[model samples]
Target: MTAPHVESDQVRTLFSRAMSEMYRAEVPQYGTLVELVDDTNRETLQRHNELRASLERSGDLDRLGVERHGAIRLGSAEELFNSRRVFAVMGMYPVGYYDLSVANVPVHATAFRPIADEALRRNPFRVFTSLLRLELIEDEALRSEAARILAARRIFTPRALELVGIFETEGGLTRQQAEEFVHEALETFRWHGDAKVSLDVYQKLHDAHRLIADVVSFKGPHINHLTPRTLDIDAVQAAMPKRGVTPKAVIEGPPRRNCAILLRQTSFKALDEPIIFTQANAGTHTARFGEIEQRGVALTPKGRALYDKLLGSVRRHVGAEGIGPNAGDYGAELAERFKAFPDDWAELRAQGLAFFRYSATPAGIEASKRRALPSTVDGLIAGGFLHADPIVYEDFLPVSAAGIFQSNLGTDEQQNYTGRSNRAAFEAALGAEVHDEFAMYAQAEQTSLEQALVRLGSPHVARKAIA
Candidate 1:
């Protein structure tokens, strides 16, 4: 008898359910993390009417914050393009492209942010995008061999492509049609083929795959980690290790009198899973899946200002240098500067004219002028600054991402370590260009503020009251 076919929508739903189940089964603590986030939001709302009202108007998932998303990458364009069709059936529109090749890390990565608020509401799905690192490998022969293997490997089945084509042409189908499409698409992506391989071949494939497994294993186009923004990530960080959730390094973002914005983070360590490997006997052997590690880097206000200044300065310098009439030169300069000063927050802060902090005392002087300065969030609040609320760092961390991949797969195995991949590759593969992640997040925050004004019935009143 043939297997019972399911619809695309149903397939999407099932996929989501299965993913959540897998995550929960593997990391039961994540469930608690979800609950904690909800509870914290609820309590926050009860304590701060203004914040509650502002968030409510934003049209985001209440208590859940904006939207929960995950990202992953695949090795091929066919998978990337076809995945778009599959996602559409589930009401997920591709939003952005991320290239991790140029990332100052070991692994190549990419991302696709979602567009459907309702689908997100139903189930916060992940965007899996992949990246190819031409620079990781030093041996041209291995690179050639690996590329051939990847090229030959069919990431998506024929049925998946057909369904995607139908969905694209129809835009959307009737509820019944939608259901059918969703089922087929999900099965197509989820189905593990029955192609038989010798133990040696299996092991070789597995080894080659580790080069990009972090991007492939997950259903999405690549391996994308879903980040949940929290005002109290530090609290979560502190509590996580005890709960079996190892805490990676914490990146402190802009320090506000009351809160910190953009605390960069990564998982404390990578976990290893078991994979089947081929042995000399041509029999199957179990091998550790490999460890997945994470890292976190903080960006302070000074860091942000320096980043901005670097862009502006690069623009000015590029124009002076006669690199281009347009802003491309400036952008390239900015990217270069960022790489050079990846962690020069202290140096940036030293340049008082570019980045300075105000004192909390009644004198209203620059903190650097005083003998004492506030270091903690609470301390800043005590100094009379209204403790600006923390903004969720709703973006990927390149180093952390690379670190995770490197941890899972040995980075040293890469054949090429030059000729980096750019963000363009990610865009071309996914067919969805990635934008400034920080800007998108900032817009979300601004939209919430705007909505709050509408709710208040007057922008002036809302501004004054909120201020």
Candidate 2:
């Protein structure tokens, strides 16, 4: 008898838990961070009843603990192309192209995540996968050597490749195959202390860019960091030092806001682990770290534009006078500048600044059965026939991401490359085009609105509202 097809969401959940367990063992600090987040979340929920209610109503409460995002850097296109297929078995697809090269980080990235609402609710595990840009290295000899070293190593094991092929040929993996796949796939992200190159080669790549060296020197692209979502990042940041974890000087994102926008990230410093090179020479490498994030409502294009403009304005102001060593001054400037953004969810929806999911509450559902119905969405909302809830931001911010990387990698590791964004080249390497995140948000919003109207038995109103 053929084995029943297991749901991809189940596979994703299994893989996510497995990854967390693996990382916790590899880096014990991660376990502490996870505990801190869990404690903070519990306190947040207990202290703020309304916040808890909001999460429960929005179906976010269930996924809070399971929600995690991890980062990994790959050295070659072949690895990236194949990795895409590997993630596909777990129901993750590439979303949002991020060019860290613009920030002079010398790598381009895309977030691989589940797009379906149910899959996300099940386990919104994401991986911020970046591909190293060897060409960015100005030294031709060093760049060629880096490329040759990267090309020589196969990141994925033979068994992992075989499993991925099986999944591709078959629609879904059986439970036995999935269990095997998870174990085999975990090997790629497992830390290997032995470097494939000599200390001299490693030094050259490190000189070009620390990230380049990290990617090219490793036997496999080990999972750099696994981020757990927290309801209160400020609490986590404040408590980090107390818990023996030293957080970065500044939280890398917008200052605190009543309505958090995009993503706010803070991380503990990277661990300096000893490694043995090809010649059995010992040296230290710093890469893996513990990261935490707090996500907020997804902004529309207009909202994002305003946010960018304000962020840029603050950066310019701070840059002109030079940011103080404390970073408190910069945070003050950021918070003051962001006051221009409205905090009220209703005002945001009214101004079309953020995406919202429309649904009929129980009261609204009962009210919709009445013969008198409102034609417009606003009227329906006014009449208690429908409700709009903020859609959680499921993506990332490029500037914030670069900041986290730079903080952990060290300020001295930064190199200025020309602002080169090669989306075409990145996509060409992946063997598939990335899904536009904005488009996905728009679709979700429209779909929610349509569903709400259908629930109200007003298809015509939905057509007019969507129009």
Candidate 3:
């Protein structure tokens, strides 16, 4: 008899649940963050009945509770190449390249996530994985030393590699093998409070860049932070203090909007955990933290360019440091500058600035069975026969990402490595090209529109055939 097998979706759901449990135990504050976000999401849904109905119609309501995104920093190309294979076993493929060099952080990244709508609705778990850029280090000797240390470490367990190879060879894993894979894979992201290098080496790397020290000193890329989705980030940001969690001074990404766009993020400070260095040296490191995210509609390329321009205009006045003293009014300036961008969904869709999933309403289905319905999407909507919901952005924002990293890594002043986006180099290191996020969003919208039209029975085509 054939062995019983579990699908990748089941494996991913199991892994994500296990990962959350481990992180909650390791960082107690994260559990608190989860509770706060859950409460906030509940209240937001309760207060906005329309929003609740929209979420339900689009199959997002069930996902809201299980959605999560985590981050990890790796030290070498070898690590990244293998990490991709490991994630593939969990039904995750990388989408989008994020270069943090512009923000002066010495790393480039991607988000490993499931692309299919059904897979996402099951559990939208993703990992924002970054690889360190040793070339960005000005100190030649320190860079070499960091590289040598990173080469000497194996981030993944022996069994995890074996299982990945097995899955690749057979194209699936048996139930027992799948369970083993999840257990072994979870080890790679587990916290290790011991440093592989000496305190002296760590200090030199830290002096060069806090993030550099973080990537090079650890045995493995521990999941630094796990973010839970929130309906109202502002509510969580305010309530964090009351719950003894200190939020970042400002939230990352666009200001609060009537219809949220792209991604908005905020996190509490990193925890200062003591580490045992080589030969019994005792010191501290701050890397792991709790984060909350609010993801809105994915945008078109035109929408993104406008967002980038407005954000650039505001960030230009702030200090080069992650959070500048001049940035006291950063939030105010951001809101003011973004006024040029429209806030309403109809205007956004009309202007071709955002992506939405179109679907036939119950009335539309009933009317279609009786007689031909309006052929155009606009007409269908006008007649209350169709509806659209903004398809949530499923990727990261590079600037918001860098800001999140710097905020938690305890870096204040950072050099601006402007005009240094090297997607070619990053892709070469990862062994595959990242997916174009805008194209993905556009395709999703078009597919939904076509499917909705099919459900309406293509009235224009039908009338022509009748004549």
Candidate 4:
């Protein structure tokens, strides 16, 4: 006799719920942030009928409430390797290699998330995991010391690793095993007040880089921040102060737009929590914070190139001024430069600037039954037989991520490190190749369009021709 195995989606949902509860308990301010976001989302939905209709049509409305992303920093290759296995049991795979060393953070990252449309619609929980690049540390001695400290510590529970092995040997975990696995896995990300290093060593690492100190000093890589999705991030940003949470100076990612693109994020300041060193020294650490995000349509490569160019212009203007709270006029410059990008959904699609999921309308299905459907996608859409909705962007922005890291790390100095994008090293650490996020989004759009076309026969030409 065999026990029934739990679906990976169910396990992920369970883990996401448990993680939220644990985080809310650990950081009470996060609970308040969540409340503000929930309120804002409801208000946004009530105010925008078109937006609500679009969400319902696209099947995104239900997932919006449960969607969230979390970030964690691992200290070594082995920790990352094992963490990858754990996430796999929940059907999450590493996607998109992001090198944050460009921001002088000394860590490169990948987002572990569900890639399948059904799985994503089920939970859409993401963990933005980063591996510390110790070699980037300028001081040879400190780098070696940091490595030694990381090597000695275990970031995962023994039972979690055992469960992972079991899942790999078998196909999946039984309900009981999965329930236990969620508890054990949660332990790996749980916050610890006790430091693994001495106060003096921590300060030395902190002097080298605040991020280095954070990764090497902690017992485990506690989740730095958990982000809840919001329909209107600017509204949440405005509402933060009223709720007693001070937000970072400017939102990261694109400036506010009528039809939002990519990801827009804002976070309250990181909390200063009490920590006791191994040598009985008492101090405080600022690592965990609350973040809110508004995810919009995934851009096409051409669209992304334009986005990068416009953002580059903004950063060029920001030269030496910094992107922190006091980075004067950064927001104004970003908005002014982004005017080159299209803000209308129809224009974005026609210009091949965004990815969209195409579906057959009820009218289209009825027309197909009578063999009255148009042969071209544009014809069908123009005749109100097919509907196209933007596919959600489910990845992180590198500069936006670094900006959030910098603001929460509470630093005035924008440290510049002498290193470049090392995708090989990041992939080697994880023991797997990272997925191309753009490819993933493209495939999703293509698949949806194909399925809809199948319902009403293939189209000879599509306006965007994702098929």
- Taken over the whole model, the C-alpha lDDT of each candidate is 0.43, 0.86, 0.89, 0.89
* Model 1 root-mean-square deviation: 12.3
Model 3 per-residue lDDT tens digits across residues 1-467 = 97977889899999999999999999999999999999999999999998998899889999999999999999898999999999999999989998888888889999999989899999999999999988888889998999899999999999999999999999989999999999999999999999999999999999999999999998999999999999999999999999999998889999999999999999998999999999899999999999999999988888888999989999897643247777888888888999999999888887888889888899999999987677677778889988989999999988898898889887875776667788898888889998888778777787787788778876342211100
lDDT of each residue in 234-288, candidate 1, tens digit only: 4555666665666543322222213222333334333443333223232322211
lDDT by residue for model 4 over 134-188, one digit each (tens)?
A: 8788799998999899989998889999999999999899999999999999998
Candidate 4: what lDDT? 0.89
TM-score each candidate: 0.59, 0.96, 0.97, 0.97
For every candidate, C-alpha RMSD to the true structure in Å: 12.3, 2.0, 3.0, 1.7
Q: Output the better candidate (1/3) by lDDT.
A: 3
Better of 2 and 4 by TM-score: 4
Worst 10 residues of 1 by lDDT: 286-295
The pairs that clash in candidate 4 are: none
Instruction: List pairs with backbone clashes in candidate 2.
Output: none
Clashes of each: 48, 0, 0, 0
Clash count, candidate 3: 0
In model 2, the runs with Cα more than 4 Å from the true position are: 320-328, 462-467
